[model samples]
Target: MPLSHNPNLLQPRVPILNWIADMGSDISDEIRYRLCATLASSTLPALLGSLNSFCITLLAYARLQNTILLYIALCDLIFGVMRVCATNVSWLRTVAADLVVVSGIGWATMMAATMVVVGFSDDTPMLIIVVASGLGSCAGIIARNYAAPRLALAQVIVIDASFKIPFCIHHPEFIPLILLQGAGFIGVAIWIMRQQRETTVRAIAGQIESRTQSLQDPLTGLLNRRGFAEKAQSMRQTSSTKALLYLDLDGFKQVNDRFGHGVGDEILRQAARRLSICLPNASICRMGGDEFIVLADCHSRQEAAVIGARIIQTISLPTVTSAGQASVGVSIGISLFDPMEVDLERAMVEADEALYRAKRAGRGCALLHDPAMSGASKAMA
Candidate 1:
């Protein structure tokens, strides 16, 4: 199948609903989902960010009798509550939202504390404590959220600036030294983030590629049986009608035996191409060997008949490949299905049985499954 027809790529995914997506349009949904899953599943990072900030802010509020510190402490408590609720409700989806909001609250706590120390000019122990905490938060963002590079970089910049701005303002003589050290810190953070993001993206992409391969028929580039089942699982509709066509290429063995397997493989690929053209909106599958299956929306037996006959005509021509030349006829059995009465398995089996009838009647036609047809024919006999 062409890459354009591959459904697995660029499909819209609900951010895992309760545990799904977290990235923006800049990032792919698959990457977003995996990162969300990783962040949500881990409790230590979020727990540390919330508890550490809350306890420190609450402590400063109680000791200084500062009303601003109390509000910051409450904001920290709210972030902690959000993290806890996300973890308890879903093990994978809320951290990205929590990270943004919590990072802001943390910066406010640090900045307010720094402003208080600067105003007093007392050079109390609180200034040292505030600076230490701000540095820790910046480091934590870089280390814990590296996979989400943009968020980490933005948070680090804001949180680091909160307390740094106060120090830069107070002592003009120390500006040069502080700027040099800050540049070095940023450079190292960028280097670390780049390395980690590359590794994480590669890992997630490999897993997705592996999964797509498993559900695929590598030879014809069509969905395999399992792949068909997976797609059908998503299409179950009680109110809608669908037709399942079980198809087999007649004289395939003769071509394989005479011209060799190379020509046979080319013939199969050509047949798949023709099916794709005939049923542009249908789910087509190569069920191993020369057998293939298709499921398409069908409103009536007449529609099923038309589809089955069209599939036969579309692939009726002799195929000429670089390997060799061969001609093969097709046999198709169609079964109409609706999710209300029966499931996919039963529909598949009915289609197979119809194909059996088509082959028995002579191998170049289409047949719709009708149990009563067999009984009526027996009565005539």
Candidate 2:
């Protein structure tokens, strides 16, 4: 019979679509937030400059009208691009050459409206006003780009409101369109921010399960070989004294041979439980079969030896068996790290050698090795 499909068979995960949606949302929020800040910061100077230019342009000769309007148009376009790039691309790049031409146009327009250039006339009060206004607008733009966007945007809104009275009196037709555009941009930014928050939450949650699985041993709930290796390497780097003990259950093969494989598995499980209990802080790992490794941060070589001896003593105790009573002993080899010889792989090898010595000495013994001195050789003999 065909096996029935179970929806629960598939482990729960954050759907890819949801993750993508969230990422998009977060990016949009960041963009909106930046845009708001930029606009707010520049608004005051922009308002002062725009109003000053608009009034001067009205008072100034028709001969200068073309240049002034061109400058204002350029300023608007330049600022629009700056806001876009700052929010959507690089958040921190304050000086953008791409915006230079537009800024130049805005400067020219502000000059045209305020100071009538009948000749090379630098002495006029109107000319001074125009230059000062242009500089203020430029300063605002720079400040907005460099600082937090929210404050900048708030300033812009205030300046824009102040300018609206004059703007309506002089050119009432443009006010409605400008307000609509600003509102639409803000709405889009809000939507994007919502998407971004959702995405980050999902991304963080999805990574948790993946990391847990990687760090955990599926069969025994101890650290897996990979996790053990990582901990050993970390300990080797930061620790002054570290010990790795390699353990192999004595007569494990005979147990597998005499009892069924299931009974042998039960014994291994029981062994793993006892080892975990004994080495609470140490990273305990099953290196497949009956071999296991424990990486411990010990105060001294004697401490490592004590831990190894305890492991052997614990595993040698009587274990409840399915068919009858069964007991097993563990042979353990421990290697303490020296400042000179602290390589992770070499430490493991020395520990393995010590374990071999313990197995040879007797099935139930523990052997400790110091790379600075002789290890287990005398005991084995």
Candidate 3:
């Protein structure tokens, strides 16, 4: 029953315990420090699971000198505890990314070393276990850092090299076979990194396209009502002198009823274009149907009136389409913002009231909101 006579035990002439020690010493201090930092940012659950399993396996087998096994377990435990504490510190969080990556490399190196040391007499079993575990670690790195290909690549290189180099040095006769396997793994890693890059880019592009569609109108290519409000809110916070002009297209409903909605859409597009030309600095938005809003910076009430008049004139111009010539006028109501009284909602209501007054005074005119005009219109009604 003695395993001392086993042929497989005699085959491994090279001792791996000394090789592991030499490999650890060969790593530069700077590289070791970086690896330690990376390990600190790695996911706590994954690290804990892998480290605990390896420690338990070593204990079960009663591997050479329980002292070495205990040292390895203690190192992993200290690293995990440091990482958990780092998450709560502001400065530590800044370097957490580097910590996670370095820590992963370090832990992987330790696992590879352990495999070689414990399975020195069983080369075939060691090869299988080491390759499988290396690939699994690579997959985990991909899952965690797929958005960052460079980081994932670095981790993969460290992991695969740790196993491959030591194995090649020990069994030079199997160099060709080992090189071929390493090349295959490198190919797989490259493919995974490329896929991750493409996926990240596509996701970012999709999000941008979705946001653009939400903020823009399909027909006129102007900002929609929601977009205008968002922009105006930010502008209002910064600027003290501002004006709001509410415009309603006159006889637009009749055009839709007579010529069809297709032609009506063309008219709206043309009107938006003309409004943009008239007020180049203004933020213009189509507030659904035939209503539009313009936010502009103005020095005085006179400047607001002038801008409104220009908009009305441009919109009144004949719109030539495939369905012949069509003319639609615009009624504008102006409201000015005062730094002392910053009430956007009240200004909007006043502008709406003035728009009605412009329509009542015969279409295609601009009227500034006045308190006296509102009371007069109410009394007359």
Candidate 4:
């Protein structure tokens, strides 16, 4: 069955055309978004400079009796004005993507039409300069919208055909030059498209990596305290019953002193891995040093205790590092949330108090937060 009709394949059966179309769409969206974003940003000075150049050109061409040049310049001037006005309108900003494509096509068409008319005109110097400027503009557009391969191709084809079609019909002697120019534009567009794709992909990947680094712990590759807090807050808002488990690894300082910080870091990584395995649904965070936090959904204090117990057992297992085998136990304090009272700060304090109680009672145990534990927690502290 044809890929287009299959309802299974995402694209049409023709591989080459499908690939090109997909690439073009991706590039167009990226370039359009970037362009719109740039225009929206504080690049007004640069924009004004570009508009000034166009205005100057318009004034210079107005002296000539060429109606086509005047018309193109006037259209360009109006487009520039609209772009400046668009910055303030919410509706215009929303439709900026479509406007960009339409305006690009319009400008390309006008420039092409101007080139065609100028080639047959009596003003030799003006014709030469206009053709040269048109080619330069094509190059500039290609560079500016490098990510949008289809837009680049369309602009090039329009401009190239404008120059070639009229010259071929009127002069016929410049056929060789026209074919050469056409082939050159095609080659350059393909090359620019490939380069732009690579550049964009790398930029996106770098952004993802940077964002991930900001939120993740360097040692364990687990979410850091800030990341955990943000995620837990969101989860609390959505879920009725949730529990926050505070865990501190026992004898971590001893291991760090005896085996060096390398082994200590490995232990933290292994502990994070274990916690993730034991409580897969929980948001696990390395809350600095030997402390870790887990925010999870629970039906009652009992369910939270069960999860806490699992985490304790998993973390207590001996971790084999390059230096040697190291053992550490975890004391967990679980704070169960009442659906009516969703105070994160109070729950955290309760959990911390419970953790102190667990440490006082024994090293390797899980304790659910209780009001009476507060006095005991103060004494231990």
Best by TM-score: 1
Candidate 2 — what's its lDDT?
0.57
Question: How do all models score by TM-score?
Answer: 0.79, 0.49, 0.61, 0.63
Candidate 1 residue spans exceeding 4 A from truth: 1-29, 36-48, 77-124, 237-239, 373-381
CA-only RMSD, every prediction: 6.6, 15.2, 14.2, 8.2
Taking all chains together, the TM-score of candidate 4 against the true structure is: 0.63
lDDT for each residue of candidate 4 in 9-108, tens digit (9 for 90 to 100): 2122445433322334443434434433432342254244335435534644664666666777777666555545444445554444444455555666
lDDT computed for candidate 1 = 0.70
The better-scoring model by TM-score among 1 and 2 is 1
Locate the minimum summed-lDDT window of 10 residues in model 1. 3-12
Q: What is the lDDT of residue 234 in candidate 1?
A: 83
Model 2, runs deviating above 4 Å: 1-198, 320-325, 370-381
Candidate lDDT (C-alpha), each: 0.70, 0.57, 0.66, 0.68
Tens digits of per-residue lDDT for model 2 on 1-381? 100111111111335312211212333443434333333344344445545555554444444444654554445445544433433344323332223223323443434333334223333554455445544653453343322223223333333333334444556698797678657644554444445435544554456657768987777777788887776666544746777788999888888889888888888888999998888877889888888888777777568768877887889888888957678888888877753456878888888888887777866877777555655432421
Candidate 3 per-residue lDDT over residues 220-330, each given as its tens digit: 988997788788777755756878888999999999899999999999999989888888888899999999988888888778877887787789999997799999998
Clash count (model 2, backbone only): 18
**Model 4 residue 17 CA deviation in Å:** 10
Q: In candidate 4, which residue ranges exceed 4 Å CA deviation?
A: 1-140, 185-208, 229-241, 254-260, 298-302, 323-325, 337-347, 370-381
- Candidates sorted by TM-score, best first: 1, 4, 3, 2
